[model samples]
Target: MALKKKKSKKMTSTGTDVNITSLMDVLTVLLFFLIKSATVSSLELTPPKGMKLPTAEMKEEPKEAIKIALSKDMLVVDEKTMVKLDAGRFPASYLMEDGRTIKPLKEFLVQEYQKKKDFYKDVADENVDLLPPPTLLIQADHKLPFGTLKHLLHTAAISGFADYQFVVETPGE
Candidate 1:
């Protein structure tokens, strides 16, 4: 009877291919996370109670901006109630001498404009024209009087917000 012994081999390094697919997948996930985190949303807009938004055929998507919502008995700015309405209208005490100026709304908008300035101050320093334009998103009851809207617009203009977007619901939704 005879027995055979196996020969020992020395371990050595060999060229190996990198798994670029897995690496790319991890990088893709990280990129998506960073992109999502870096974006700052203005606010979530849920239709206030007792308010019906008008429907429209939207041509473009709305961007991030300050929101001015007029509910049944309140005026809201970015979800914060700025003025409590009286019978769906602003209280007399909330108006200025001009009668069209919404005192509380104007004040809150001015403060918000200042905040936007500070937030984009660095950008302004780089290029004065690069600063984001002050914009407002107006959400109001469909039955609101045109006069009230006019006053709201005037107040927003005086408060330094020059651009506006009227919020609306689309058909079938």
Candidate 2:
């Protein structure tokens, strides 16, 4: 007697497409969490000795950045004295050829700005205009001359450090 042979069916993919919207939504939320957790939002800054800081009702802590501090006898950056002020004024020789920029401060600021730019180079978006500007955190004595800050700001702007923030003493709650 001859036995009948049975044919096996093969499995094949269907025409239905996979929906990726849910996967994309999950990825976006993870990216947001990583960005928020990785950054430092507060700074540990101490006022220069013998310097009086202005008080404020600050709602948030200062973020980390390059710091510049000015006092009567000296000018400091990152806790290092950059220059010895002559009664709260920079020396005439410290001025650059343009007669506006401070040489030492400009040099330091430019180098720092370059480093920051390079760090953000890979992080830059398609539009160069959207790149974040370099920032400076300034801590100055309340009695400092407006001219002093004005000069510093002008010099910094030339070095591409246009966005700056001030560090003031926050009063107790």
Candidate 3:
């Protein structure tokens, strides 16, 4: 019997191939840019003393806003303050337990809105090269009564503060 030898076929000429180092560098730069942009988009919220915030599932962050602080006894909107019903002192008009009186939040919100608008106008002019439109930021206490929150919401809506960013805690953190 005669033995037959098998021949091997060559697949390529030289081992030199395309260099991917530049491609890898570009990808790394792109990744870093994306990470930085994502961080710049979210907003942070901090509650006041003795006040906790509720949580939400939405992750959107609004830029530029007026902050509203809701405490157990008071409601604060950028230096403007109002005492809650339990405090026995009403600012304007509020419904009493007897339903004879009322402490409305309209005036306060209107005043605040005007103040903010003027301030923004001045600042916007000074920094024509920069600055953006304003938005509303609500940082109500978690334990705050629903009535206070509802009234504030209404006031804000009426005052042209339609855009709102409700500050809250992140779950499981």
Pick by TM-score: which candidate is best?
A: 2
User: What lDDT score belongs to each candidate, Candidate 1 first?
Assistant: 0.82, 0.80, 0.63
User: 1 or 3: which has the higher lDDT?
Assistant: 1
Lowest lDDT block of 10, candidate 3: 95-104
Superior candidate under lDDT, 1 versus 2: 1
List ranges where model 3 is wrong by over 4 Å: 1-44, 84-105, 111-134
Across 78-111, the per-residue lDDT of candidate 1 in tens digits comes to 7888888887677889999999999988888889
- Cα error, residue 118 of model 1, in Å, equals 3.0
lDDT of 1: 0.82
In TM-score terms, candidate 3 sits at: 0.51
Candidate whose lDDT is highest: 1
Tens-digit lDDT track of model 2 for 8-105: 66567678999999999999999998887664645678788898977777755566788888876787888999888787777788878876688999
TM-score of each model, in listed order: 0.68, 0.69, 0.51
Ranking by lDDT: 1, 2, 3
Clashing pairs in 1: none
